[model samples]
Target: MQRPAYGQSPPLHHPVPQHVSTVPQLRSPPPPIPQQQHQQQAHGYDGSPYQQQPMGAGPSHNVFGQYGNFMNDPAAQLASQFSQTAFKQGTQYLEQNVNRYVNVSALKHYFNVTNSYVINKLFLVIFPWRHKPWSRKQTVGPNGQEGWYLPPRDDINSPDMYIPVMSLVTYILLSTLIAGLRGQFQPELLGYTASKALGVVVLELVGLKLGCYFLSISNESQLLDLVAYSGYKFVGVIGTISLAEIVNKGKGTGGWFGWSVFLYMFLANSLFLMRSLKYVLLPDNHGDARGPMQTGDTRAKRNQRTQFLFIYSYVVQFAFMWFLSRP
Candidate 1:
């Protein structure tokens, strides 16, 4: 070791290190663990630890953080579920049954129906004789439902609901106009006309259903088919009424114009129904011509059935519509 300089700090002396003894004090054993804890360890838990997931907060975009708890009500959740279920059920029911008697989609198949076609169909209703026979233009869809590929030009069996629906509205409006022109218009009259038209439709539908049952045509399930058939009279009625409206404006006719139109429409409607409803009412190729096994009793019965249906569909329906359409 070198000696310190005169002006520098002197070197410090180091004390010898002494070992301090960690006294081996007697240690007390940890207090005995509770029996309850031991039991818990042995049995895991009394009930399921993960009973259910915590409900998450629903999305509330741009909402203040304080109001983030909205839409979390249990009753609201239950009501939402109920409404969703009810809506689903109601729509499903309507979808299936709405088209049972009238398929609106079938009427508006753009390729099959047009303005020109709609106008042309009026003549078909007036002159059903021009249509020779029911054409076999049925096509089976992917869902196994059969439908027309294109409506037959003049056949009564051509189920064109568009004509009936359109002509019905037209007929109502025309009748209303005629009534208004004569100062006979009433708010209730509109209701009367609409109700009358609808009543006739329902009545006709029921009548056809019954007719098919009594006749046992085996085609009664074609209820909408018959509905379309029955609606044809509206066309002739509408046409006749329109013609009468023009003729009555001559000032001397009093109201003969309306009466004259009613009579002519009656005749025209009868003819149309007679021709169109025959296939349903009358079986073509009567007698032994149809089959060798055909019995005389069966033939006679069919003839009688045909006669009954001819009158029931033509005369009876014409009377009903004629009476109802009176302003």
Candidate 2:
């Protein structure tokens, strides 16, 4: 190569060569510097302004707190800690079934009917009937000696016996008619004493009778009128039992107590009234099944004998009624 003059430019030409040698040159690219590829993880976006810290390590973000200092405080854990979130969760849970509907009007009517029946029964329990006094007499014989015949004590003061006995009889007849009308003839269903069923009938009848009498709506008692009201109580009890059984986790034991003890009051009172009936209604009816009357026989046979005595005793009742009707 020769340097060109300052004033003249060199001519661009290739020189003719007799022989040529070629050499390969090696130049490596700068060792690729590992350019870190920033990636987004589940915790946060790659370009997020705020940094994420390990959970429970630093001050926790208290969703519900007066000051950030109380954020990580375990003692501050409360329902309000995530109240809005919890409320949202709860709202979503409830909203999932918001379309569900219940028969509220029917339930309300049913409760009304039950309360009405209870009120009527209370009236029957409190109302005073004519009190009959037992009469004793001393007979004077030819020798001027007085022989005394002891009089039995009447049960005017016993509310338990009186209320239950009257209620039972009234209910039996009332429910029999209701069941008969509903095209049911299974007397066995009637054979079992269900206080609530019986209460329904008796209270309904009493309510209808009293309402009609008081309001001067009608003097006569129709079978349908009693059945209609009793049906209400019956339906009410069924509804209550159904709701408690279905909606509550508690077992049916509590329901049984409610049915047996409070609503029915049948078992305890039945024993009492059954005992009183023998002594009060059938004195001569000496059936072990009978109250004070003593007899040796099976329960069924005793009941049969006692029924006959009861029929006989009713003659005395009619006579007493007739005497009372006298001026």
Candidate 3:
């Protein structure tokens, strides 16, 4: 055969060298660049594999579907399962033990600030109002003339009347006694209130104990229950007595009023016990007036009736409050 011209390609009809055909077989489409490679190339380079995929497949499909399979691989699945298990366990532990994290010492501080706190400094200023004469005396003058006058014994400032020590002590004693006495009677509603009051005390104690054990707080005072229960009685009795007076004034009679007073008095007392907080809060505006019973004044005698009226009014108010505080 004649030699080919210099630099001329071989004839198209001529058979190609076996090596050229073998080279194409060796290339073999490169096993379609593994999914990971496509992912890397799609993200790492300017061109996107999403653009090359079928039109029906969205961009998210190309990015996630290709890689999501590996994320769900056996080893990855096991790691994910372990992570979920640990997370659930941690959450459950926190839920079951969160009470331990509560700061119950704060509750004690709140209680001290709210109940039985003797702020004598502020009280010293307010106590004077109790001494001011609530009522004045009047009598017929000589020669059939009417005259208004102060009582012969007008000592409006009496330490004993305003101090409230006796009232507090008496209230506490009477409350305990009445609660004990009445508890045996098993009156339907009154007994219910008493039982619930006991339950509240128990729950408070339980909370206190748990708080102490887990949170390192302490609540060792037994008087807390006493004061709490006493407060209830104080309010309940005061309210009941007041309501009885109002009822007696309007629609009630002797025996009816007396029994009504007895029945409602427990409600008033319960209110007092429930709202022990009232002992601590007071008005800031108090003038330096004379005491409840001043030196040598019979105003106390005339005003004693008024005081009794006030006591009864307070009883009615206390009963209402107790009813509201239930549950």
Candidate 4:
């Protein structure tokens, strides 16, 4: 092509045109697509065939559906079932083992005492000279059987482990306090004292069991009942030691004053035991209706049991109390 002169209005040159195709050309970039239609077609490049969906549809809609599918899976169902079975079996095993050695209901009864009952029982234990009836109150059961002892909350004569447990703990604490006051307190001394006190109680219990066995005593009283009765001596021992200490002005539990106080407590405790145990050792005598007539051998055996009871109440109590009261 020849260049046009600058002065002359550039000669209009006809531009060479390329071959036109049948497809129509876009004007102004095909007028920009509507925003809604553009959004609808936005997923075109995801390599998936476009399908019309509801306006608000999104990934969030499938969340619960996926979860439901997972829950319906056999593996998940089986795992859930296994966990429930394991929990139930573990619960049953624990309950069985717990029920084996421990009498949960009986323990509840022993502790089911009222404050009034406790106070009255304490008074009776301390002073039995005035109180008349020593036998425990009996009730008729649903099965029409008599001789069902009333709960401690209802009867003062009902044996309860509550007082015994409290008194034993108190005794140990008081002993620790006494040791502290006497400048004999040691950390290990607490354990030693508790062990010694418990050991003495065990020995007394064993001795009583042996006596019961040899004397052919009825097994109406449970083992815990015997423990409760034997533990009464601790109350007297506590009184004796405490009074002796006070009398000696925290100096020591020695001298005639201490001995006199101890002797009084020992005698009081012995009397309490004698009265309390009378009902247990001689149940046939306490009932409203007299039992079957006894043969000579039975009478002789009863007399022997009576003698054994006296010796145990006085002699054994005296010996144990004297040993325990030592500062």
Candidate 5:
């Protein structure tokens, strides 16, 4: 090595270059992140041990495959068993008790009705259009189709026992809410609610049964028929009380809503009874079915009697409801 000038740096020495290795490096590529890991990161969830394995494996390879079946699901098994047991019990109870009381054919027929028919009747009870096709006829066929021989009218027999019961329950619930709003809630009222409503139902059934007996129609009617028919006023009662609740709700009494619904209830109930009771009240003339046709005079008389009976029945029902539904 020669010495450079005073300002110049010393010469650099290059080391011998290392020989290039002919063999490739054995290091593996970093494993790609799994889709599950990405999902867990995005959702901020710890990847569960249950979901660690890839899906759609053969039964032989999958350890959790048997658990995939519905029978192996704890929650699904519990719900299915509970529902089945409840349904079986309910069906048994209905068959034992309710079936013996009511006409089975009639009950099944009523149950077969569509939701549209019931909803339409509910709407029409307010509007009551009196036109062709829409107009309700009070007359039954000469063969007394109103009897068990034919199905009851859709508009007349809609909802049956279910509506009455559900409406009464809803009424009690709403009344409880109203009472709570007024700071008058009492758990004791719940007991009285069931008893009083049930008492009213029993009273109405007895009253209607007595009336039918007096009218000589008891032979043709079952006790549960009166029960069903009498319970129908609860529908109007529920509607009226609901309107009153929406209006009164801790305030003063319903101003327009109360009176308006009351009036409508009266009219609707009367009209409903008119259509529903016509068959029972005014059966076709016995002679017309076999011998000669009924005279117009007799027909008119029956119609008049039916009209009077309807007015009397609905007015009585309205009065009973007025007293029963008072808050």
Candidate 6:
């Protein structure tokens, strides 16, 4: 090493530094500060008190959370209650309207029956020859009326709407099935078939009403009874059609065997009606206590009514069956 002079020019030499290692040294990171200490440090830096808030302590941060809060709101709860009350009131109004025209309690009686009664009634409708005493058994009703007929559960001869309703529905479904099998089915065909069946029922009802009016035998309660008896023909019609289908195997409704089955069913149904309607048409012969005492003119009128009953049981049934069975 050489030193430089203060005032005079002189040669100078710089000192050499020491060598440093090229490899890096490893060191652990410092431990994290506590939450309180961190918050205090932030407060000191900002000159204000810093609050450490818990998770979700502020306003809702997600859509689901906001929706939950809204549902708990009092306004939303009140709206829900109002909708429920409106629905109940609407249901009550509809029920009141329906009960105005229809006798629901009386209708329920015709549907009161058991499996055994259904089976036995079906047998009687199909094969009515051996059955005796077509008269219905009378029973004391809840109101103590004496003329009320026994429920179908107790008497197989009693008329019931159950079989008729079930048979009618089955007939419509079967008709649709047969039409589909025969390749004559259409979407509109269902509506057409239903309309036609309902129309036939309406026409028959109208004719019966007209006949009763002319014969001076009009009755409101008996209307349901007449409808039930008239609907029994559907059972035979169903049997005849089903047999015809099975025999022909979806081919058609025309054959010697089909015709034979149809003729037999028609005759059986005619006989069933003849026996069943005797009580309704000729109340005098059946010993109905509700009927008035017979007079000479009433007796003569009953003779004419007897002829009408025969015509209805045979002629009307045959015509209707033939029409229904047509392909």
What's each prediction's TM-score? 0.57, 0.19, 0.20, 0.69, 0.58, 0.73
Q: lDDT of each structure? A: 0.63, 0.38, 0.40, 0.79, 0.62, 0.80
The predictions' CA RMSDs to the true structure, in order, are: 14.8, 23.8, 25.7, 11.2, 8.8, 10.5
Candidate 6 local lDDT, residue 86: 100
Mark the regions of model 6 whose C-alpha exceeds 4 Å error after superposition. Answer: 1-88, 289-297
Backbone clash total, candidate 3: 42
lDDT tens per residue, model 5, 1-327: 677989998878988658658657889876457976777655444556665544443354445666567577898899989999999999989888976866685566445545676666566555554612422233465775642332334544433555555667876787777777788989988777767788888877666666655545423434544565666677777778777777776453357778788778877776766665554555545522212223553655655666557655666777777865677
Model 6's C-alpha root-mean-square deviation from the true structure amounts to 10.5
lDDT of 3 by residue, 271-324 (tens): 332232111111011221211222343544434434432443355334433443
Clashing pairs in 1: none
Clashing pairs in 5: none
Supply the global lDDT for candidate 1.
Answer: 0.63
RMSD of 2: 23.8
Q: Which candidate model has the greater lDDT, 1 or 4? A: 4
Clashes of each: 0, 0, 42, 0, 0, 0
After superposing candidate 3 on the true structure, give the runs of residues whose Cα lies further than 4 Å from its correct spot: 1-102, 113-176, 179-191, 196-327
Query: In candidate 1, which residue ranges exceed 4 Å CA deviation?
Result: 1-90, 93-112, 134-157, 250-263, 283-297
In candidate 3, how many Å is residue 77 off? 46
- Once fitted onto the true fold, the runs of candidate 4 whose alpha carbons sit more than 4 angstroms away are 1-95, 285-297
Tens digits of per-residue lDDT, candidate 4, 257-310, equal 888888888888888888877666654743722122233337787888788889
Give the lowest summed-lDDT range of ten residues in model 4.
288-297
Top candidate when judged by lDDT against the true structure: 6
Candidate closest to the true structure, highest TM-score: 6
Q: On residues 1-327, what C-alpha lDDT tens digit does candidate 2 reach at each position?
A: 788879998898888775555545679865433422323333334446686654543333344344755755676666456786888999877755653643333223222323344544343222313223222222454576543221112122222222333444554455454455546646775654344445445654564456434322321113332332223222223333334434433343154443443233222222222333333333344221212334443466545646543432243222322221111
TM-score winner between 2 and 4, please give it. 4
Model 2 residue runs over 4 Å out of place are: 1-195, 219-223, 253-327
